[model samples]
Target: MQQKIIILDFGSQTTQLIGRRVRELDTFCEIMPYNKFPKDDPSVIGVILSGSPYSVHDKEAFKVDLSQFVGRIPVLGICYGAQFISYANGGKVEAADSREYGRANLEHFDAENPLFNGFVENSQVWMSHGDTITAIPEDYKCIASTANVKFAAYASTKQPVWAVQFHPEVFHSLQGTQLLKNFVVDICGSRQDWSADSFVETTVAELKAQLGDDKVILGLSGGVDSSVAAVLLNKAIGSNLTCIFVDHGMLRKNEFR
Candidate 1:
């Protein structure tokens, strides 16, 4: 069984980037909209709450019942995810005096904390949110902070929940990948075994078992996903697989030719 990380997307534009970074770390992850977050999954070792464009204070903003997996699994929140965790736990979030949308230095942070194990003091981080966490709940402690954002990051004293007010998925934030590695590898205890070879091997085996001697027809879309699927099918059933490509009139000039 593959160890997995679940990312609850709140419509953040960079939500996919979060999953991409996680996969790059050799850990498999799935991104689902907050409303459709799964309830029970034994393979899920960690959960990530993605940022959103909407404010946590907004009544119509996307919300989820954190109790579903808060204390049971390790959780890391980013940007809006951080504010939502604070706001949900009786903390306070308010519009910032100014919208922070660029690089900021981490003036102070808890070096002893596992989240910042390899992080250096005064390291740069990417910030891009309009709201800031003004106060944290009693059970949560501020673990990191910037010159502008007081509660730039916090960890729950009672639960396995940690959050950051910056965008760690983006490359602009130096040492961001290290932070993610600490969370997913050190804290969550995930074995970095998920890789292209592993995926192909596992997928091929499953395909062979489910499609044994069965002829399969695939639609080739000239895209990465479909092309990969075609390759997998070919590898599984050899001459039993048939591929059909359609000229949908949407291809580039002379693509059909």
Candidate 2:
């Protein structure tokens, strides 16, 4: 089975970027809804908790049982993910005195930890959270900090849990990719064997097994998703695939063409 990372999306604008960075590390990763957890699947090597637009302190904020992923596999949380893990783990996540946005410098980080293996002293990082992790559990310790934000980063001493208040997926953070590399490659022990060929091979095999000898019909839309699906289905079943382009007759001029 191919090893992969799972990123739980909490509706952050940069969720896709996080997946992109992971793939760029030559590792396969899938993003699922925040509340969804792939139960007992061995293909998963690590789990990432993504940031959210809503604060962890919000009455209607997104919630998930951190216990679902923490001890089971290596976990990395970013922005809202960091805050949520802290808040859920009996830590204190309070509304910040002010929104800590934009560039911040990590004045101190634990060099002994594998997560910060390649980090430079006073490294730059992007921060965009409305809440701060004021306190954490006794088993968890601060791993990194900015002059302004004391608890900019943290990790659990007992489990495979790590989190950062900064936005490492953004381009502004120069060493952001390195941090992700450290997490996905080092901490997660994921092999850099994911490739386009492997993806096509596995997906086509699954499609063939699921759709054997059965005809498939797909709506022909010129959009990215539909187009890609059409190609994949065509590859899987060949002549058994039928495409019906539904022109609702309400398209703008030249749209049907």
Worst 10 residues of 1 by lDDT: 247-256
TM-score (all chains, Cα) for each model: 0.91, 0.93
Each candidate: what lDDT? 0.92, 0.90
TM-score of model 1 (CA atoms)? 0.91
Clashes of each: 0, 0
Candidate 2 residue lDDT tens string, 1-257: 88999999999999999999999999999999998889788999999999999988778889998777789899999999999888888899888888878999999999999989989999999999888999987799999999988889999999989999999999988899999999999999988999867888888889999999999889886666688888888888899999998776766788888
Residues 96-181, model 1: lDDT tens digits: 88898999999999999899998887999999999989999988999998999888899998888999999889999999999999
Question: What ranges in model 2 sit over 4 Å off?
Answer: 246-256
Residue 162's lDDT in candidate 1? 94
